[model samples]
Target: YNIHPSEKLIQAFRKKPYQGCCPIQAEFLFIGLDANYAYDIEEQKIFPKVIEYHKDAISFWKKYNVHHPFLLDGYKGDGRKYHKEFSKIRLTCEDSSRISFIELLHLPTTGRNNLRNTDLDKNHLKYIHQAIVSQYTKAVFISDAVFRLMKKTSTFSWMQDAREIEGYSLKVFHETSPLIYKHLHFSTYGKFQAQKEKEMKAIHMIISKI
Candidate 1:
């Protein structure tokens, strides 16, 4: 498979840097490091349909009809292992429409090790800001690496009073909105199975507080 995004998709990204179902006014936002696959013209072809289907958080998760290419496993039985772990926490709550997922870097690549800082320019930061603003996100679940990067930027500069939880950390600027939890990347959850329950509980606690 060609690992380069199509020109059309690249232009589309200049307007909307996020892939997958991102609902309007999402309560829970999960931010990943980067995309795992480069999107081609075929992927671009379905963008409109996907956007139409993802009208709101409730519609996006209704019967679990999520339509993201990377998250197709979610529509199947158990989904990917990391998604399964995310589901565990999501299931703890009643409103499914309040959850959403996005990435720090919209550019697609095979893995994080292959990515460079140059890939995350001003447009990417603007996209993140736009996502948070448009969605009115209540809480943000971020990977450790992405957290480190965002910390240097003004977007996450408001984050203060870091509290550690099961080897992960949670940062908050206020008593209520936009609780930012910094955790080990979901891809590494399987390797730390022994600590999974603890981490899940801690994450659930954060969700409940929000």
Candidate 2:
């Protein structure tokens, strides 16, 4: 019997837990060739669908080879590896009551270039974004100005009258390094984020000391 690729992920995560940055029952994005898909920045678009309910599931990471981690040569070719990485992250960070939601209100306008200083294909990114919307409810996304830059042929179109998710708060920042494939970098955005949080707490400690 053939199982849906997604259904397989769901069943696996139920038996274990996720490690690293991915959230519990939280959705993610996958972008690559149709034959072997993975993750990309476009996955942020699915943020609206995941806020109300919590369930057990695993979302695929865009695969990368160990030989040339930066080049998009081939899929990692190991579903079990994906499962293990996610499971370990989930188990390690089981106490997440301290985390908070942050809305990327400017993504539709600015795109990933709004954060990173690189030009990327908007259509490819849109494909990844669509996948995210299909998976999770409260995923992060781009602003209209950012989205305009990612387009293929047209100049730019702003998504005016865009509405915010109910009961959600917004936080805008000049920089955003996401939590995808962060394990590859020597010091990943995940590490940097943790450091930033630690620094903030340290300042608080100093303030209390004074």
lDDT of 2 by residue, 104-150 (tens): 12121211123331333454344344433433423333333333333
Which residues of candidate 2, in runs, are more than 4 Å off? 1-26, 29-119, 141-195, 198-210
Per-model TM-score on C-alpha atoms: 0.64, 0.24
Model 1, position 165: C-alpha lDDT score: 39
Residue 1 displacement in candidate 1 (angstroms): 15
lDDT score for candidate 2 against the true structure: 0.27
**Highest lDDT against the true fold, candidate:** 1
Q: Deviation in angstroms for 52 in model 2? A: 34
